[model samples]
Target chain A: MTISQAGSYPSSKGIKISTVDTKEVLCGTALIKRGFAHMQKHGVIMDVTNVEQAQIAEDAGAVAVMVLDKLPYDVRHAGGVARTASVKVIQSILDSVSIPIMAKCRIGHSSEASILEEIGVDMVDESEVLSPADENRHIWKWNYTTPFVNGAKNLGEALRRIEEGAAMIRTKGEPGTGDVSQAVAHIRMVNNEIKKIKGIYDNNDDQELIRISREIQSSFEIVKETGKLGRLPVVNFAAGGISTPADAALLMKLGCDGIFVGSGIFKAEDPLERAKAVVIATTYFDDPKTVLEAQKMIDEKKSMLGLDTKNLDLKMQERGPTI
Target chain B: MNNELLIGVLGLQGDIEENIKATTNALKEMNLKGKVLSVRYPEEIMKIDGLIIPGGESTVMGLLIAIKNGLLDAITKILQEGLPVMGTCAGMIVLAKKSYDKIVGNKRQLLLGVLDIEVERNSFGRQYDSFESKLNISGIGNDYKGIFIRAPTVISVGPQVEILSKFDEKIVAVKQENIIGTSFHPELSGDYRMHRLFIQLVTNWKDANKGHQNF
Candidate 1:
């Protein structure tokens, strides 16, 4: 671990810092937040609606399960107000599963996040899939003890979310669509932007760095940090619209730290088999043979009917603040 | 000890890279020669001088091991043959001889049962309840920040095990011969003292086992 002076900035947001011996140990700081996200690396986090589905996900070797009221597909189909999962259901799933249980809250909904935190949900996704509570501004996540994960389509959005204290990042591909193209594009875009910043940092072009930071609407420190790290400050997982084991593997191969299946698993013909296969594929993403074995475990005909991202009336990826 | 040692971090899931980086840094700080590898397949367990089971979901780690044929057996056999191993948090639970949920009955999960201890899962509550504390660990000096994230606690231990540290009168760390288990993650703590100690254990074990056939 490269122990950077993460919370060294003089901000009133209360970045807690504690020193142990000569070593500067960060507690309730960036390390704790990023460390929590790091635990989910190279694994699969499945989305499930209820206790039974959560149990099946646990049984399928998922690192964690995301608990939500409705599958993203159903949420889109219903065309009504989408909200957080029920307290009763979340508690029951928490009791039933040994792995971490993550729940989604509407973008900028701090009260829902507080309730989830009180209920002891492991992590909160300030997800765009849910109707945005306040589209103009996101919650100041640094105020809360619980870590929040936000979605981004490109580098500026990712840094903005990270600046707001999101411990993790996921590409906000069109949710409810089984398509992986938008996710692929989003990750590539983020990677290219990172590469551009890294070039500026490497050249020691202070003026250019400032210009780029302004363009991204993030502080010079965070943009510089992202350049130095050559990646997002937190774990970046590929989410939204992943349905198959191959899709999971592709994301892993494309530099995603992990995989998230939203509407993909439950909507599949064989949820258990598909869930297990995706997990396997993700763990052994670098190995073609194992990926092939995982591919054989699921039937292509049983996959969800994917939506075309080009024709979506509701684009979750575009919901959050652009700058 | 050999000129260059090879250490493996069990890479089925969870914080594998963090452990690898920490181990590499520990090796460099001690001015020792070693390489850290992420060991995913069961057969790779035999090639490492030592092993580290990182923090993740114990249920997922155990289940993944059980899914792959001979993985559990492979790890258990090598650990018994005295390959120094350190398990942190979820890793600690996986190494325990027995495990139970704090709120409910015994958990039906795959544990290697190498460490002669009983661990209570989620004894520190959920992620929100997770915290960091300074500990006076034996031999490593004091004020080492111990980060517990949805961590577990050792409920009981056998005679062979030595308690290393504790918090609120509960066991948080243990050492038994070649095995070391901590309910908190040393890799995430930013203090490499614990990793250094584990590396020292690995060096000692390698020196003692010289040309043993199992190694």
Candidate 2:
């Protein structure tokens, strides 16, 4: 909430301002977005975008949780479109927690966001790429008040999103897998391309989005070589293959605002316990005291969704969630 | 007694302060007196001259609003009272009489749906999908630098609603009597003219209210 002359708070990557009079509570590392209420006053952001996991994350000190479009167990089983399966799962997560819930719409699923609006999730992340028609065809971020935190592979893509209106940025982890290479590439790209812009993107330019993405793609090699996140286009967070607190900590060292633990928690041995531990790792990335304390709290509880819920379940996933 | 005029900012979610800054600055420029306050309490609706709903994530705000003190009922009352409300981006969605689909529709979509329009959330795309344009506002005269970030698009407008601006034939701005809705961020552009126009609405309301009070 500390706005400068431009009416925005400065971030390592971009401006962090709030519409609510409520301050960002960043004096020390309080988290935000994944069931934010329980966050242990660490400014280190801990954003849990998955709903079933959000409940556990919220209980375990997540500053905020994101309510994303979940890959339905049924849809995964039946092999259909990533159909909206656990719509109510997200709603239940939102209903249960006071922290922000980030609702995601896959690339080109703008209509899906409308349902999220009705469901009342907090933020959004358009994670998946559009179908060839949308991605190859290209679709831009629309205007929204929910400060959007987008994923970029490099500085240019980050800038493109910022230039187009992204308030925050994260390195795009080549989704649907645990590949950290894409995440690494994104960091390199952002660090290399940091010096190229002044203001965030606020226009609808096709060339700009692609150009930025290219920069991000190119810098992946450089970032890997340097082993550092150079300069993010906005407040940078890391995603893709982050499962453990130690993994979360490594990305933070690599320069991320937070880490999006996608399949990490829900797929963990103990979701609730690991959710707490991840929250600790995200905010206390640099602080050993907090990290150790969070580690002690880890109680390895079996994650609810079994192997049957794992990917390649086209039928069960298509069957959708009864919840 | 002179009825005090007030402006309400949809404190539901998002940038309530930005609108407060612009609106307060513009009102000051117009030689008018008002207060910019955070409206977690819906009862504040009764004391304002007008309402300004700032831009932010509408989904979060719409969902969280019910839990924020007594804001829900206050918004419902203000709209029913015919209080002038202006919405920008996410604010526009909150002000619409209907929207594409929302999260908690069963408990009733927490929309104060007062305006005669259907607003689609994130219609413009994601943050990376965002774009800016030189929007030619109908009544505001000058082409304001429109800042649309994760903005919405008006899918359908009620007959009473007037389409104010468009980009590539997409409806981005609209107006209906006292309610002014747009898909872009005007305050972000440092333009006080729109605030002035809204103030004019407040002033006119003051004048009309004065006449009614006397009678």
Candidate 3:
């Protein structure tokens, strides 16, 4: 009963204490923000434009709702400078749902992020779904307490975003395409790169490891950690072009920590049923029967007609920092 | 035979992995034989000697546990049966008997209601107001760094609940029998002292109950 009793278990592990005195706990450490992201694992984050849509998302079992001024597809067609949702719109959705509300801020738009933080949004997305505010720079995320989720297409992109203090990372698949192929391609690229890093680490190729870290524009420490863990040090979700339960399930199976559905739910005829189905699919992604059951919840003909990613003019995936 | 303690972290939502890592590190540091598992179902509750409810969005976590998974009753039963449980942040809110969101007003939701205390959600205001400070916990070692992230504040406690720690004269931690609740996230603090204390409590509880029943 008391831990004083001697046992056969190994006691060789020595205790290590962190010597660094943390003067400021800062909004949340990368680890703490990553911890928050972990809470959303196995859950769905739906994008909503209004209070009603927010309620539908919540009622459909969405763990969180991303507040947006326009759906990604609408933004694509309207062709204007996309920015953070207005404070009034965000406040209305915040008032409507008990679940956490996340809002999108344009890439490198720290001012927009600050405003969203000021208005009390739970999380901010340095979203590729919105127009790039700055071509060469990203929001120095460490300056804010609200965690930021950024999009990445490959390991280097993912690592660069993490280096920039992104608490969460998602694949920058072509949004509004209703196509899962690009998302699949991005995730696979990241995964393959991770596997290669792990192989190099296993082979004890320190020189190659350093080279990869440089190529990725990330710290060697984080790069090595990712190699050892065989996954991104932070939570990675799949986003863009995910329009169905099956699409969500596919990404989840492909090793995403979670799935983000923008323009997928509300754009559908039955947002309620589609959202709920996507949530179920995410929760039971590995089980084909469960995914099939979830898939049965929707009417494909009534779903939003998705564009092919190949024909898209603006490539949001290629918009961020190139490292 | 080795008496290895098994700790379960509620994995339904919130900082599940971080708590697991912290607990694992704590067990190693204390030279305790234990394994930490992330518990997602009602049945997993029976397999562990202690539990941790991590910080996360309380409403979503509550909805999943109390409604979607129907584990609230099961959790309450275990707490009454003397399961040593520690809840941090939103976890603390979930364990309390009464809780209110300061920004959202007096709308109360379903909680575990095990700890007899009142909690005001986001007592430190918004994410912008979050801060970290070293404080003296009543029983733990001195200068424990507490990480407050949109943290809740313990406004009141029942006669039986003991105040463990405070920040800026605000209630931040409390203990009632085998249950422990902290408004700030100890798991995120990179310190294992709190978890070590919980493990010690679990060991003592196990020792006391050895002859009474098998856990």
Candidate 4:
């Protein structure tokens, strides 16, 4: 029977398929959430704490704003439990900006995710930058209708998140460092792993593919899909240590679909100009001349004093599961 | 064999890729040859036979159009020149003569003012209130899934505008001249009927305007 004629069939918990056209099922399908995430491609998602900051981000051309209780660097320095932002703050940010607003919940904090979803936040980031509420489990994201983004340092970690129903993935770079080294390293590692998997898929090594899937703890279908695509099934953005326009452009050049600025924007000496510059750089990432022009938009000394990732006492990137 | 049509999706912001994919799929299903490109620069808009404005943040999109050098003027000129354009969700908001967000108070956004209609942004309440329902578009067949996510609703239409579809008795889709606006997202609905309709509109326009100096 055709998909349209097949009648209704039980699928995933939230999703329902009419079996009529298997490819055309609409309601809670991965396509809808992925399509939402794809909307933010080649754009910047800035972290904003208040209505004013959200306004600044929108004016500076941020495609979306991440509602945070404190900047990532501040979270790192405070050394306390960094949970999700209060409903009040999120509501204010939502009211202040017409652009999409994303909020961060502590890893494994599904309650916080539900709250944000209830309040109508566009997306939620199960961010590692926030203190982990549960070490053994990340949010079981498929249970919610709102799309989610999670961080990963390698292909296996990325696949695991996708398996958990993450609609978007970003490198869990050492956030708030201002040094892009960790972000770069994570992105390269994931890309290299994808290349290796592609090689296995090209050889039609089903057993090896199964072995890899078992090792990664991700489903075989998703792992094989990743191998075939030579990349994560979802949009891969670079997050964490992005500070300067040059840094943002560098990540885009390294094949990230987008960049997320956390402590980078508001912590800089000139946030307004810095934010605009980073956006311009991201948009014209392939043009060296335009990147240079964007680079000139801000002063080096005025940028947030970047921390050396190697010297950091805590590495948020290492917080998430490896396999 | 230079008879290929180029369709452009406004790439300034929003759900651009999905629209591109949907349009491409629509073209393929129709057995038509067409190239889909994301239009960022103003000059790029001049080369397309048709245009699509995908859903996103209407206020931000308007700000970008206002700031982008010559983009607003370019779009206005093209619309006046009878370029076939489809605006979905926030895109529909951008094409309206007037738009208001009740939650944001009395402030009205600067829009293309090309389509003579008034739009209420986020008329469907919050994001959680978003839902999908089968719609019977005037031209397209019934049971076309229409996805509404923080969608706008057309409150009023001008004499020239033709209402295509409605949900809950609210105007959700319309057409005026070469422009079409839908408060729901066709790209996300996994149905390419609306996109197919737009493609057909583009092809017809191309045929009628063949060899015309200003396309």
Candidate 5:
């Protein structure tokens, strides 16, 4: 019943918490101004344990890093069961980082997740929907204090996560398969479905109810309307399969909130350079102007080994919760 | 006696004073009596023709009402006689027949039991994870702002109940004959039209019951 932390304090750094009554919602650009607008900085979600590789992302502009089950030098695994790792790994990352840290888990591994929350990890993911080795396991329960970011194989999967308390959504491509199309298709589907229901669902509020319902459906359309699928996520990005800065630019064009390059950077020859390009691509996913400004870096070829699907531990395959 | 109608606001807990201030201020603005009385006794139930159960943690409110002398029995007796009641957030919770998660906490918590709905506490996750969104409500002309803080969602609306509104298809509000329930709080805002609508229900009921009382 007790949360570890709450309350706000003013700092000399000029940070302030303006309390907005989210109870009753208004329509139009106000929602855009308040809810979905500020997350435009395409977040970087790094899922590595080695501090060196982790720093590559941090330096290259990843908004946050995800500490994982296998250390980079372990050479024994790529990912693990709903987060089957030592608690100390997560604890160390919490100690080492100032930015947010993310961790992965299987559908029912909520107990482990609770431990991660205790470590103060900022976000959690129910991964494996992208991993080619396992069947999909739907995760509706996430027992942790950190906000969740789930993967969507398609639109229905995405909406279900939103209904189940997930704060962020991303498209899933088969990890280790070196494919970006699945991620692209998934993003398109989510955008279209939300637009259709936006107005119909918007109008049906009951007056006799105590408080007025004051929120509008989020504009998933912003992601769909954008032309390219190889996107740089700026707002709430969790779409993976960004192999290069070009791929990232496509996602930004597709309106992603952030980027998750599980294998894209680590598997690449120049993890640092690729990471740098991705950071630039997401920072300006839109404004042909900004992406154009970041174009020089976007064109550079940084080859990644891609996940060697055949060599991956077959036993490690498992389905994760939806996005 | 006052030309304007009188309505009781259940001052149990959660967003109690907020609802009172909003409802009272609304009535003042409308030039209506709208006496927003804080009723904790069965005797108090008879004073106001209508009631507003503002949003709150239901379990706590139920426990408190259970200890308030004969208050629980009084509420049940009044509801059995068919009084117009509107419950928001936790208030809507107390109106239901049963709640979820094996109903932990103290045994004193009981409902007035007017509606047949089954409620699940924290159905949409815990309070910090609870969200506010605009939802379509019946009778209200526009979208009512739904503030779902530690809200109780109606898992199953019983036979006599009418489903009111939903978010992502989850039932967030419901109504039965004289009792209305919502998962969100309306009194938290400046909007008085919904409060006005409930008052009209009470006024019309009082007007209809006057001749019957004399008989």
Candidate 6:
């Protein structure tokens, strides 16, 4: 049925019409960019390589999928320059799935980010998992309309990325290892620092706050805002080595707004079951019984053979700029 | 506890915190005694006077809720029994009886199927085409910021649904009695008028259903 025929109101007859001015319809504003990331909060974002993988992620209830040329584990094994996923594959995945599709660009690679944005990818990740394109600088994210999710090891990198217009932040845990230790450490470190800043702000110690701001290399205002909010200004997710339902739940319990699973699901013996299990664990992070049920959904023997962060030759988390 | 309103933002996925914050602020501004929670469990879903399904991927939300065993049924039953609910953006897609993508075509996901509307997902195109506008939300008033982010537009509604707001003559907001659905995200906006209106609906629903409280 048509609007006027089915509904009670007859096509704008009794509707309170404004002057019918063409209100400026603005896109890619900061609110729009940041707001897009907010919609992904409390959800699992999985890494998918092809159309089939993308569809699997969608079937498993991933809020979004991040497309990559190779999963991080395979990237580590390949040990070469990993660029964005092929245009054909990305396009196919985008066309195939109704959920938001994200693609990761090399650190400091503007052209790659621009290309992905041009293809209408929902979000871009200026990720360190891919080989670094620049040694000294990360891409200035504010230059583009496409929202970016940057990884951070501590509070400094997070606020710096936010200052550079990164709409979302995730901990740069040791990628490809499948070990949750580094991810746990990074989020805990970020949370501990936020606690410290909140304490300084609560004490009305502007001097200490400014000193801490300089130390972290974040803007004083953003630092103060972080302190006031007692969390990152934007959504913070845990990424890199998340591999199990318990791993996902632990990060959520540690205050990650959501999760980004890379090599976690696909590398497991039962990708579908593991993916579904992780989504459930993340959704009910605070509930132990549900988490336990999720944990049992997958066999421990089927999990990816994890590497220790200390033994890795190429540490991806150390790729981005220290300052 | 009896007089206080307990509102919930469906926590399966997407913008749960934003809705919680918006509802909390609306409660404070209106000086109402209420508690807003991020709810996921069926038991939790049964205890609320009102619920908000936040913006995210509607496919993911529907799948997650359905997998939770009886969660979708609980939400549908509550809405049918006069529990006030507001769905925004992808949330609006979940509330609709039918939804299809403008490009990829028909989807096969679980839906609450409570709101009597057919929604066209990504009707304004992809994320790159997402935009913001000033709309006259009939009940909430004018110049309301309508942030449409890869949003849906209601193609048509049944006679029971009341069209509340429109942009470019497309249905962006509709109310089917205790249930309200919007194509734009009110939680993302700085304005709390829409949320205030939702809380008002919740308050009135609670008053009318007095001894019939599900909790």
In candidate 6, what are the lDDT values of residues B124-174, reduced to their tens digit? 887777777798998778889888889999999999999999888889999
Error of 4 at B207 (Å): 2.0
**Model 6, range A186-274, lDDT digits (tens) per residue?**
99999999999999989889899999999999778888878877888788999989999999999999999999999989988999999
Provide the TM-score, chain A, model 3: 0.91
lDDT of 1 by residue, A1-323 (tens): 54333323335253455554444433456566667788888889998899899989988889999989998889888888899999999999988887888999998898999899889888899998888888688978887667788899988888888878888999988888999998999999999999999988988888898899898787898888888888888889999889999999999999999999999999999999999999989988899998898999999999999889898878878885555
Q: Give the DockQ-based CAPRI class for model 2.
A: incorrect
| Tens-digit lDDT string for candidate 4 (B17-38) | 7789889989999999989999
- Output the better candidate (3/5) by lDDT: 3
Interface RMSD of each: 4.0, 13.3, 6.8, 6.5, 16.8, 7.1
User: By TM-score, who's the top model here?
Assistant: 1
Off by over 4 Å in 2: A1-46, A49-323, B1-5, B101-108, B211-215
| Residue lDDT tens for model 2, A1-323 | 21211112234222234221221212101112211111112222333445556656655545456554442222233343553326767767765554446666654455664566456554556554212113431124333334455666655455455444444566665543433555666675555455332122233343554454454543332222222222432356776555567666777777665667666566556767777677656545776765666666654344323332133322211121111
Model-by-model DockQ, in order: 0.46, 0.02, 0.24, 0.30, 0.03, 0.47
Tens-digit lDDT track of model 4 for A1-323 = 00110111125454634432232434555655665676677789999989998988888888789998989999888997888988998998777666678999989988999899889897899998888888889988877777789999888888888878788999988888888988999999999988999999999998999999888777787778788878778889999889999999999999998889999989998999999889888877887887888899999999889798888888888885444
Q: How well is candidate 1 docked (DockQ)?
A: 0.46
Local distance difference test, per candidate? 0.85, 0.55, 0.80, 0.82, 0.55, 0.87
Clash list (residue pairs), candidate 1: none
lDDT ranking, best first: 6, 1, 4, 3, 5, 2
True contacts kept of each: 0.50, 0.00, 0.33, 0.22, 0.06, 0.68
Candidate number with greatest DockQ: 6
- Candidate 5 runs further than 4 Å off: A1-41, A70-82, A129-143, A199-238, A287-295, A298-301, A307-323, B1-215
As a whole number from 0 to 100, the lDDT of residue B9 in candidate 5 is 74
Residue-pair clash count for candidate 1: 0
What's the CA error at residue B173 for candidate 1, in Å? 0.8
